[model samples]
Target: MQIVSALSEISDRYDALFVDLWGCVHDGVRVIPGANEALRAFRAKGGKVILVTNSPRPRAGVERQMDAFGVARDAWDDIATSGDSARVAMYRGIVGQKVWHLGYAGEEDGGFFTPPNVLDDPLEIARVPLDVAEGVVCTGPPDPSAHPDVMRPELLLAKTRGLKLLCANPDIVVDRGDRREWCAGAIAKLYSEMGGESLYFGKPHPPIYDLARRRLAKLADVPDAAILAIGDGPLTDAAGAMGEDLDLLFISGGLGAEETGTPRLGDPDPEKLAAYLEATGVVPTFVIGSLR
Candidate 1:
């Protein structure tokens, strides 16, 4: 549990790196300063880097977003996203099954599937017979204003019907440029709390890490022991790394709401960092202000 300044310190030790996208490499809108340089340096040293993200968009869509933000595809060896993973899971079972999607209407269609029934209105869909559907998938952002009392009737419907809830993204909340918004995982978590069953398909889950590792193995001759997971979020990236038994390099410049003065946990203070970690019980192997 030591602090480091840059990725170069551990570059030689790790043959591959699974880097988080949103808060670590870039904000929602723009790439972080020196992030590209750090990746280039890692590549120069013959290290493979994979962009691992919890974005609910498909791999191609995520790449398009990266391209739009000037993040070159050549910077990373591969890209794996929760949306892509979920799509794979969905199609692997129950072809042509009815799915009640509970996110943004069009967002889930990126690569997931065009189910027989695509219900944008949760209330309208709830009135229909739930026995007709195979399962429920949460892929879009929740609209709190859609209902005053309860914003998630879809979860209730899924629970009542004893249907499986597939959560595409495991991130509870993400920093969209400057605004923080609840993603599909938040709703999935809420449903799980209410005695609902959900299958998560993102970071903090072993499958996504396995996919990244498999892809990395093809690009680099590094052992699993020589791979590192670098990210800003403790819950997703750090926890995922620890679960996979990989090294961790934490970026603390993003994802903190309070401007406390610490610079390690994105808190402006050490006390804040300690408090946050104590509450979450997520401790990283190394910490730094930024990748630079």
Candidate 2:
């Protein structure tokens, strides 16, 4: 892979960018130093930047969190969250149908819910028993550390009922603060393995990328070849870029740094990093230690 120290070195090559939020821009707790500035600089040069994220919350909700983190509104042209795509399915008659929700809606977070009327009005699709629900909307486990075994019974029950699942986030794991935690993808994977029909709406999946491209095109008349996808997850970001036929800028120092024999910000071993990317089978156009 061609290694670069700064995004500015290759900024002129693309007219638009699809940037991942969780690992590339922030670690769920704080913004990565220089990451936001890199995007701002890209925007300053007339390139459109779309903050595409696997966050299971709606775009507005994700924006609220970004606002709390002090992310400048002008850093990107627009935002698209996995929840936005999943919500599309909901709005397309899914909400009117009896659906079940599986995830933790923090007491302070209004976008999450569970059975027993945990979801608020306009979002409380259906809270009926599993046998009565028509589909499942999995945001993630109720707890970060929740294992598949903890949710196997429920997923298996859904499978037995032949219910379809709308997975808001296709990420199996995410870096929260200083630790890795399970995500909805893990549960969805298990559900599919057990004969359930699960639909994912995030990176590495076509729907979110399609939505992002539409939004990006509205902001700037850019061709597919002129857009670059930047992220830290090899499986999600790199895989998604390849599937979408877009150039990828892999951030090796984020969540996948361990595969390169180091932690975030530590110097990556070139040979090991190459092997890691090869294993993933998605070669990025460039590799950078950080988005800086």
Candidate 3:
């Protein structure tokens, strides 16, 4: 893997970029220092920027969040979210009709009940109680700060009933500015470990990547070889890129900041970065401390 100082080093190679949002572009609170500039520069040079995210929110919801975070509107051309993909699966009755909603009460989860418009004559899903639920739809835990294993009892009951969990976001955790919180993926991972079946539609999985390609196709006819994937999550973004056979620009400063020993103003320590990459089994084509 080659460690580059900026996106410009390799931006000329790809016609399109599949960029991850949370850790690459923004830290959940604000846009990264060079993210907006780099993306805008890419778009200005006639390159397409598709913000392929594992966010459980639909594109519109992501837009709103981006606006709240002060992210520029011109930074991205389009978005393909895990929420939309999982929403389609949910409406297709992948997890049955009567499902139990497992997420925070007031948070914006795109109403989890709302059906995607792409499907014709979609299934009518209801948020029934867990006792009567045929499946479970998890956006995340009711409490992000709480450990995912805390729901073991509830998951145990659902497992006994043979209920499959439809995981909207396949991210184990995400950083909201400075605070890191557990995500739906963690819960789904735990459920799967307990012998319960958990269905994922996000990164490291093909569903969301398929959705991203369709979204990109709506704008241009770019081939798989002409695309570049950028992100911070080794398991999600890196694994997903490798799975899709795309070149990856892994941001070491996101989840593996300490492990990579990336300083605030320079490239990561080469030895530490190599060790970290070896441990994670992620072979990124390019590595950057941040999107800059």
Candidate 4:
């Protein structure tokens, strides 16, 4: 992977960008400095940016979260969230009508139960207890700081009943301004390990990319070759881009900052970056310390 100084070096090569939110644009809690300006600059150049995120909030909720985080509206053209994509599946009754709602303990109204605009005949979803539910809809850990194994009792019961879990977000852990928290993917991974089926809809999965493509189509008919995927998650962003046959601008300074030896506003050490990428088994098209 080529280590680049800034996004501008390769921004002109693509007509659209499937930029990730939690890391590339914001550090989960707030807008990362330079990210908004970088995106605004790209938009001014006639490029469309789709904030393709694995956030467990619906697109509307995502917009609200962005607003609350002080993330500029002009920085992006549209959004495609894992919550919306998974909600479509949930409303379609992929996990049956009576399912358990697993989400963050104190997260705001995330619109996870809202019907997506795409469905014409959506089923009524009811959140039931795990012992009596048909399936599980896991948005994330009930407590972000708690260990994922804390929910093993519920998952074990669900597995015994042969329930399929719809994992809304596929991120294992996210750094919320230096505090790392477990996500839905970790719960789903544990479930799968315990012989329960976990259905993923976000990054590293084709469903979210398909949703993103539909959203991008509204703004421009950009080809995959002309659309660059930017994110900090090596497994989600890098793997998703590779799976979708799209080039990636891996932002190492977000999640793997320490591992890659990346400063807060500088490029990663080439040798350390190489070793990290090798360990992760991902080769991004380009690498940048931050969005700028």
Prediction-by-prediction clash tally: 8, 0, 0, 0
Model 4, which residues run further than 4 Å from truth? 105-110
Model 4 per-residue lDDT at 285: 94
Candidate 1 collision pairs: 103-140, 260-268, 260-269, 261-268, 261-269, 262-267, 262-268, 262-269
Kindly indicate the candidate among 1 and 2 with the higher lDDT: 2
Candidate 2: worst 10 consecutive residues by lDDT?
114-123
lDDT of 2 by residue, 81-187 (tens): 78778777665645346878788544354454422221344444555677788888788877769687688888888888878888888898988778899998988
Q: Write the per-residue lDDT of candidate 4 for residues 63-174, one digit (tens) a residue.
A: 9889988899999999998888888999999999999988842235546777777899999888888888999999998898999999999899999999999999999999
What are the runs in model 3 whose C-alpha is more than 4 Å off? Answer: 104-110
Among all windows of 10 consecutive residues in model 3, the one with the lowest summed lDDT is: 104-113
Q: List where candidate 1 sits over 4 angstroms from the true fold.
A: 94-96, 104-110, 114-131, 142-149, 257-268
Tens digits of per-residue lDDT, candidate 3, 16-66, equal 999999988989988888999999999999999999998888778888989
C-alpha lDDT of all candidate models, in order: 0.72, 0.81, 0.91, 0.91
Name every residue pair that clashes in candidate 3: none
lDDT order, best first, reads 3, 4, 2, 1
Write one digit per residue (lDDT tens) for candidate 1, span 1-292.
Answer: 6667677877888878899998877788887777888898888878889999987777767888887787766678788887777766666552124666767534433554532222332221221234577677778555723321264565676788788878888887777776777777777788888788889889989878877877777776777788888887778888888888888876767664353244432323567666765676667777666766
